[model samples]
Target: MPVASLNDIKAKVGADLGASPWIEVTQAHIDTFADVTGDRQFIHVDPDMAKQTPFGGTIAHGFLTLSLLSQMGAGVMMVPDTTKMVVNYGFDRVRFIAPVRSGKRVRGHFTLAAFEEKRPGQWQALHNVTVEIEGEDKPALTADWIGLIYV
Candidate 1:
């Protein structure tokens, strides 16, 4: 969806939401991320060692799950049009609610939390994102993220 001005986007305070798209977390993906982040902990890198943990097998890193918010949220962004360059501004709150075990599918449910003007041609938006595990009671991650847009 196209971006919108702060004022225009504000009208969507009670916007209807779209369904989340599911994504599978694979061992290969986790290994790649571990290599990228230089965080090759056994819980996330060694399947055999991870088996003894409550999680049963190597799990994807919390940050890796958090990073998928954008893709899952893409189908849920409410802005209709009015800006360019929507960049990752920051996060308000972030929590790793549950372990994302490898081979499990996770999805994100995005809800617009707030939108305000930061400048004449710039705006900031807050999204409350919940990433749920395919069959788990607890969500894998929950975070309030910010995005900055320029007209």
Candidate 2:
């Protein structure tokens, strides 16, 4: 709900283990990303070529999918106070355990993994983000996202 205290944060921790703003990985999205990142790997940019590969089709880049975590998990968290600011802290034990193929819809599940006080007005939170790929047995991605909230 609002900015939670170090202790009050427990209630919000491990909360919202879900997804929102569902998105589908399309050839177009992948192509644009390839243009931006100069990563026009056949597996990610060419559907025909990728189809012959192990994954069977072009897949979204792991980083591109990971980049959507916050967007997909939107409304799942907030700092209640207007004065509070949230800054990305970093990641923990991040791993791309699976592939997100094109044409697949994906969403994120936000689970508060841990929290700690940084200072009198700041706190750090670690969230376990599980991104699932629709119709896939394995999740597209899993990462521990950290953020610093200033109250």
Candidate 3:
């Protein structure tokens, strides 16, 4: 995580934080997510059947890609050292704009959208997050994510 002071965080509002390292979305990962979420959609798990679809082959679940933001954002955006805890408040909006086929690489690009002290020692932040599929013009997804930091 990018450790910073409260004031430092405030200073970075509306700034582009950075991009996370690329992460491969393999078929194994997709299958495991399907098992855990019980979303056994043919497009996500049935490789042979999925080949007939326009996606050509199995594609990762949209939620699976959305869930990756946490892992992708851990170091890309962060709270100050004084913060006792942090929480994923939720997202204002989320759009799955493109498909991420199995075996593809993706990364997250983040921008600090909003930051305010809701109350003393409690801060709320909004992040504009985009998941880019490697070598693809269109991003896999975009979200207005929110986080709460406790100091």
Candidate 4:
């Protein structure tokens, strides 16, 4: 990711910020997420049982794919040179469009939807993101993610 001036970044509203490297969604990743979130649904942790479902095998939890935005964004997001800190400000919208089966690769595609100074030293940014599943026509999810940057 490149470090740019606030104005420079703001100029990129509506521009594609590129994509993160492909990351395989493993059964282990699903299990860990399920354990941590206490959402151990059979479809996510029980491969044999999951095989009976439409997905054919265990699928990653929706939140697991959503949470991966952090890792996915790191390689694609831009940082302001004067930024002091940045924090998640939640999402405007998020939709899980498809189930990511275990072993499938996924990556995020980001576009700068909005960027503006909300206060003297605070900036709010909105990124329109799509998490694409390798070899699949449909994406796993889409979200309008917001972030607060304090400089």
Instruction: Give the deviation of candidate 1 from the true structure as CA RMSD.
Output: 1.8
All candidates: TM-score: 0.91, 0.88, 0.98, 0.98
Q: Which rank order by TM-score, best down to worst?
A: 3, 4, 1, 2
Best lDDT among the predictions, by candidate number: 3
TM-score, model 1 to reference: 0.91
Model 4 poorest 10 in a row by lDDT? 1-10
What's the lDDT for candidate 4?
0.95
| Candidate 3, superposed: residue stretches over 4 Å from native | none
Candidate 1 per-residue C-alpha lDDT over 33-149 given as tens digits, one digit per residue, 9 for 90 to 100: 999999999999999999999889999999999988878877778664755677888898999989999999998877777877788887777888888899899999889889887
* Selected candidate, larger lDDT, 1 vs 2: 1
Whole-model lDDT per candidate:
0.84, 0.78, 0.96, 0.95
lDDT of 3 at 36: 99
Deviation of model 4 at 130, angstroms: 0.3
lDDT of 3 by residue, 25-140 (tens): 99999999999999999999999999999999999999999999999999799688798999999999999999999999999999999999999988999999999999999999
lDDT for residue 45 in candidate 2, whole number 0-100: 85
Cα RMSD of all models vs. native, in order, equals: 1.8, 2.2, 0.6, 0.7
